[model samples]
Target: MEENIYNNTYSLLKLIREKKPLVHHITNYVTINDCANIVLAIGASPIMADAVEEVEEIVSLASALVINMGTLSKEHVEAMLVAGKKANELGIPVILDPVGVGATAFRKKGAEKIIKEVKLAVIRGNMSEIKSISGISVKSKGIDASERDIIQNDNLEYGKDISEELALKLNCVIAITGVVDIISGEGKTVFIDKGHKMLSTVTGTGCMCTSLIGAYCAVSRSYFEAAIAGILTMDLAGEKAYKNLKTIDEGSGSFKMKLMDSIFNFNHLLKNIILR
Candidate 1:
């Protein structure tokens, strides 16, 4: 099983590079640049076009569509719907990042509307946001996951239950990312314990994860595997970035740079290391 994951990820990364699939993003301004950069780092193309006038046109040219609710606004929400409907009509895979859906009624309402309308291939979010959207009562800390909602060893089954329930309900893959990333589909659940706490300190890691998922989904047949690959790429790179930390004074700023570097260099890393 572990080997299958590594091989599948390698194949997806190689396919992404070969195809250079364009990923259309109707995302927030807070992490728009980082979201674009990470998609490029992972060997895919990104276009950030949220204006309603051209959103559907851009999404038509894209291999995958990403809908993010980071900087939630009524106008952007409309654009997201337009793009998502177009993608669905064309059979293009769509990934949703329900950023802070648990934080406010507006965010929650917008997210629910998207799910109710768009046929998402995958729904990626933190524990709190996923729980809240699943109709499970949860506590949220602004845009972050509440400490109480995070998945841990003691609550692993509980986390899986929520993830699977949401995935089954939405008929899409559900990925809850945090200290213990849980990705659940119709019949399978994957847990990734490969991230660093420093990952949370960064501003756009969650958005970046969604971008990665979009990239993989563009070239992969399995949305579930694509979600796992997306989350694994970020988690492994984050863990590697922290491992490569050198100076004592290096903070989250430096760590962010290294994190991007690790992602950009992961293709090269695979060249030298044997998967077996």
Candidate 2:
């Protein structure tokens, strides 16, 4: 609702393209490629290396680190710890995407362990995923947010309260991407309701969003603003991508490509879009 929440956001996008910082990722393999390209699309370089044997070395050269538990394993979590710890030691912000964290004990345990061990700059997930991490899960649908758990206009205020509480408790930004993305941290809550519903139909959109956040983290002055910038980019990109499909009736495949194109040309498309 504030002007800085929108008007000042364009500067962050431009800064990312100008700085071109390297982002390190220990993300899931399912959307690893998508995450890398999306970071590149937003004008930051991506260096994805999850091997525990060399994560410390790799993270030393990165400006930001993204840890996604979308596809987790013992070895992957081990590497995440290595890379995450190194990122913290170097003062490199780390962003976590707790994908499917509510679906299984394994993923949940892995996410909790990472949270405890590494000080994250941002934790990006949907309602169910974020609620689960905060010790409250309103049923999850695999990796998706439960319909019953989504934050609608009627529950928007309540959603902001809980998300802010979680951000305070965790000492990091809480980013929940959904019908209306809510970002809360440092006693601030910024909501960006710019995305299309068709975004949920595509796979790895959340992962890509986290990666975009990581890229912004690399260059932005505030993590809260960086989260807003990253999520706003994806949400606005989704709107543009879906608008392109309305005339032809294409599906997710076409939508995916167009989404990337929108991000690739984000500087032009993102101008003057008002925020809620």
Candidate 3:
């Protein structure tokens, strides 16, 4: 099974590089550039278009669509609906990143609306955000997840149960990312425990993960496998980025650049450390 996963991951990586799938993103402005760069680093082209007028047309041409609610706005929400529906109609995969869903009622409502109206292939978020959408009580601090909400060794089983429940309810893959990332869908679950702590220091890492998922889903038919490949790619690149950092202060700055470089140079060797 592990070898099959490795082979699948390698094949997906090669397919993305060869196909260069176009990913359409209706994402937050805060991490827009990082999202685009990450998509390119993963061997996919990115188009960040949230204009309601052009979103439907853009998504029609894209191989996949990613919707993020980090910086929510009325106009952007409408754009997401437009693009997501068009993607669904065209049979293109869609990935959603409900960033900071528990931080504000506006974000929560917007995310809910998107989920209700669109058929998402995957939903990716931090523990707090996932819990919020899942109706599991959780507290969030602005955009960052509360320390108390962090998934730890003791609550691994609890986390898995909640994630699986949410996945079954939503009828889509749910990825709750933290110290140990949990991905649940199709009545099965996966835990990825290979990322470095320095990953939290960089802004837009989560958004980049969503974009990477979009890239993977564009070429792969299975949302579960696409999500696993995406999270593993981010985690493995994060580990390499932290290792390449020279100074302590350079953690965020250097790590950001190295993360992209690592993704660009990703190979089968990096897949060995990814825990299932």
Candidate 4:
């Protein structure tokens, strides 16, 4: 099964090279440029169109659509709903990032609306955010989660159970990212024990991850395969970036640059990346 997962992940990476799927991103402004650049870097074409009037048209031409609720507005949320519903009708995959799902009433309600309206292929978010939406009572500091003081908090037993239950309930792939990333669906759950701590230091990394999942799904029909690959790619890139940053200074600026460089150079090693 492990071998099959690795094979499946590599196949999706190869599809990125062959199909070069077009990804339509209705993401936030904070990481708009990074999201677009990362899409191109991963060998996928990206279109960032969020206006309600043109969203459907843009989605019509895209193989997959990504909607992020990081910097939400009524207009953009409407556009996301329109585009997401249209994508569902067209059989185009849609990935949703419930960025701050538990942070505010507005965010939770907005996320619920999208979930009810769109047939999401996959939904990705942090532990606290995912827990909140999945009916857990974990608290979040704004958009970020508080550290787990207990060592048991990092256990996959809890995560796997939550992921499996939520995936079944939502009828969609659920990706929970943290020290370890888990994707659960269809009575099976997969975990990718990769990624660096520095990844949490930068903002919007999770949002960018949602877009990358969209890019992967654009070329592959299996949402599970696309999601696992997306998480693996993130881990690989972050590990590589940490290696490059080992000699650099410790400012947020330098860390951000190295992270971007890692994603930009990720394609060069995708074929040989190790996925566990």
Candidate 5:
């Protein structure tokens, strides 16, 4: 089953690169452009539509749906709920990014509502957010994690446990992303020990990750396959971009473009390196 999952992911990556699945995103303000650009770089089309008036229609036509609660509003949440229900009814894969789930009561409540209302194919978030939703005892400092003290070597064991717990509860794939990424679902767990610290310096990158997951799931049927593929692909791209940046000047701007370029370059190589 694991081999089959990896094979499926590689095939899905190629399919998305060739077919350019249309992704409908009702995402936050931060990294919205990054999400769209990353989608295009990976050979996927992106459409950002949050209007309640057309969210249903837009979702109806999309190949995949991505909901990011990074910058939440009452109106956008309503639109997301509406679009999410339609996607669920139509069997379109939905990827939820509960960005700052533990940041505030509003964020936590909103994330809970969405998870309960939709059968999300995947939920990707940091340790704090994951712990919050899973009923663990991590105090959320703000929209981001303030307590990285507990993270030792990405704490792979804890990550796997948390991922399994959440996946079992939601009956969906759960990915806890940090220095390392842990993805679990369907009684399977995988750890991706890739990615660079440089990625952490950039804002909206995590949201971009959720968008990538959406793109992968748009083309792959297995939730686990898509989640694993998406994380590895992003990590590989980030490492290559970081290496290239060393050759030139280093800054978010140059690094960002190289990230996209590396993704374009690694499209085929990644498929071959995929564990199967």
Candidate 6:
């Protein structure tokens, strides 16, 4: 099963590179550039269009839509609804990153509204954000996840339980990313533990993961497997980039560039060496 999963993930990576799927993003302005670059790094094209006038048309041309509520406005919310509905109608995948839910009522409302309206293929967030969206009593500090609410070794079982429950409830894959990532869907769960702590120091890494998931889902049929592939790609790249930084004696800024470089140069040969 492990080998099969590895092969499937490798195939998805190849497909994304070959297909170069168009990923439409109505994402936060803060991370919009990073999201676009990350999409390109993973061998997908990204189009950021939140205009209500052209969002539907843009979504129609794309293979996947990513709705990120990191920096929300009324106009962005409307665009998300329009694009999400259009993506649903076109049978394209939609990935939602409820970026700062539980931090503010406005963010919580916007996240809930999107989830209620769109048939999401995958929902990605940190622990507090996921718990808040799942209706659990958790608090978030601005866009950052609460450290206390983070899943620890002792709470692995509980984390799996909540992740599976949320996946069942939403009828989609739910990925809670942090020190460890828990991806659950269709009553099955997987834990990806191949990331670097430097990822937390970087902004928009979660949003980048969402865009990467959009790329994978664009070509893959299984949302669950696609999501796992996306998370693994980001985490593995982070691991490699951090090692590169250590070798060169650089900081987070250099690590960010190396991360993208790692993604762009990533291949099955490196996958076998890094993914185990």
What's each prediction's TM-score? 0.97, 0.96, 0.95, 0.92, 0.93, 0.96
What's the lDDT of the predicted structure labeled candidate 5?
0.84
Better of 5 and 6 by TM-score: 6
Q: For residues 98-175, could you state the per-residue lDDT of candidate 3 as single tens digits?
A: 988888889888988999999999999888888899887777888888897787777889889889998999899999
- The parts of candidate 1 lying over 4 Å away from their true place are 271-276
Q: With candidate 3 superimposed using the best TM-score fit, by how many Å does residue 232's alpha carbon deviate from the native?
A: 0.3
Candidate 4 regions exceeding 4 Å error are 149-154, 246-251, 273-276
lDDT of 6 by residue, 11-116 (tens): 8989998999999999998999999999998899999999999999999999999999988999999999999999999999999999888988998899889999
Worst 10 residues of 6 by lDDT: 266-275
Worst 10 residues of 4 by lDDT: 145-154
Residue 94 lDDT in model 1? Answer: 95
Give the distance in Å from residue 9's predicted Cα in candidate 3 to where it truly belongs: 1.2
lDDT of 2 at 101: 95
Backbone clash count, each prediction separately: 0, 0, 0, 0, 0, 0
Q: Which lDDT tens digits does candidate 2 get at residues 188-261? A: 99877779988888889999999999998998778999999899889889999998886566999999999999
Sum up the clashes in candidate 2: 0
Q: Candidate 1 lDDT, tens digit per residue, 61-113?
A: 99999999999899998998999999999999999999999899999999989
Give per-residue CA lDDT, model 5, range 219-268, as digits (tens): 88787888887887788788888888865457887777888787666656
* Model 3 accuracy (lDDT, Cα): 0.88
The candidate maximizing TM-score is 1
